[model samples]
Target: MKNLYEKRIDQTKQILAPLGEIHTRPQFGGYGVLADNVMFGLFLQDELYLRATAQIEEVFHHHQMTRLRYIRRGLPLTLSYFQLTDAGWQDPTLFLQLATLALNGARQERAEKQNRERLKGLPNIGGYLESLLLDAGISNQEQLKAQGAKACYLKLDTDDIPLSIKVLYALEGAITGYHEAALPAEKRDELRSWYETRHPTATTKYRR
Candidate 1:
């Protein structure tokens, strides 16, 4: 006695099950399709729209896939999800391949988001630097401040992670809640002096 949308959800789940732990949950007047808990697809009115990142969007474009959009307050708002065409649905191999890419991309985006949250309130600490800090065992703002910028810089250097002297300023700024460019001249000079004392031969100029 399932409705058309309910039956479509079951069909969609079966098609995506090969990617592992496929499930659906109600979302934004539709159903969000999740692979192993990371949402990577959307189902609306029996049409499937796969989640997409910038990289995956290019692939979807190449396949002539259209992005999902809805009218909100008379304005059309396009989303990151790309529709799976009838041909795409008929081809299980291509469908799963794109679905897999979407799932991986979604997972990566989620991880980056979580990492940014973990390092929130730390100036100049975006995803790449956040990862570096996590790799060096400096996971959060409190840990970074407690260890001090010099120690954190040394930890990164010890791990053979090549970073500019600006990172040193960035860490200090993170502690003081100042933008790296806005760091006090004296503090900047002190940090530069410390760096010179440690690695005298280095010639990496400071840039914001």
Candidate 2:
């Protein structure tokens, strides 16, 4: 006989199938639901939890779903995962709607979190430079990438704070997810060219 949680896991898969292929793997105590390796749902005991964002969280509230909570290191921690109320289980159409919202939120959250972690590890993208980027409305490494390193560097109003070529190297490392020292010679040369042209006192110029 399948356990109650197991049956709920199966039912959750059925409800989520319309979204895409729902795969399951053993999680902490129950199962995690994934599509294309992206986590969108979680099953624990008799309840199912879905990702919640500021916007989609209202759906959980509308359905009277509670946020999922678990203990870690003897501390109660509540995550963005929210329980699906009876309304979610009884209606497959509603389930798919809520599931898609949850998945989108999860994808965005995961991406930002991954970018933040990556940025923290990057050379020249420490606390202060990150603050400058955020102040300039560049939130994450992905956004920094969309603007490109030179554009972002030029965006910084460094009238009091000295801007140098090294900051450019750091931004490149942040974008490529590698150390600035690992950057190719051509890329470094290109950065130097842009920097010299931008800096009023930079005497060097691109020979070509």
Residue 184 lDDT (model 1): 99
As a whole number from 0 to 100, the lDDT of residue 172 in candidate 2 is 86
Candidate 2 local distance difference test against the native = 0.71
The numbered model that scores best in TM-score is 1
Give candidate 1 regions above 4 Å deviation: 1-3, 115-208
Q: Show the lowest summed lDDT stretch of 10 residues, model 1.
A: 154-163
Task: Please give the TM-score that candidate 1 achieves against the real structure.
Answer: 0.54
Tell me the tens digit of each residue's lDDT in model 1 across 1-208.
Answer: 9997787677777777888888887654677788787788888888888988888889999988999876532335456789988778788788888899999988887677556547755787877777667544465776788878877776555322245788888889988998989999999999989877766666554322
Q: What local lDDT score does residue 180 receive in model 1, on the 0 to 100 scale? A: 89
In each prediction, how many residue pairs overlap at the backbone (N, C-alpha, C within less than 3 A)? Answer: 0, 0
Superposition error at 151 for model 2 (Å): 38
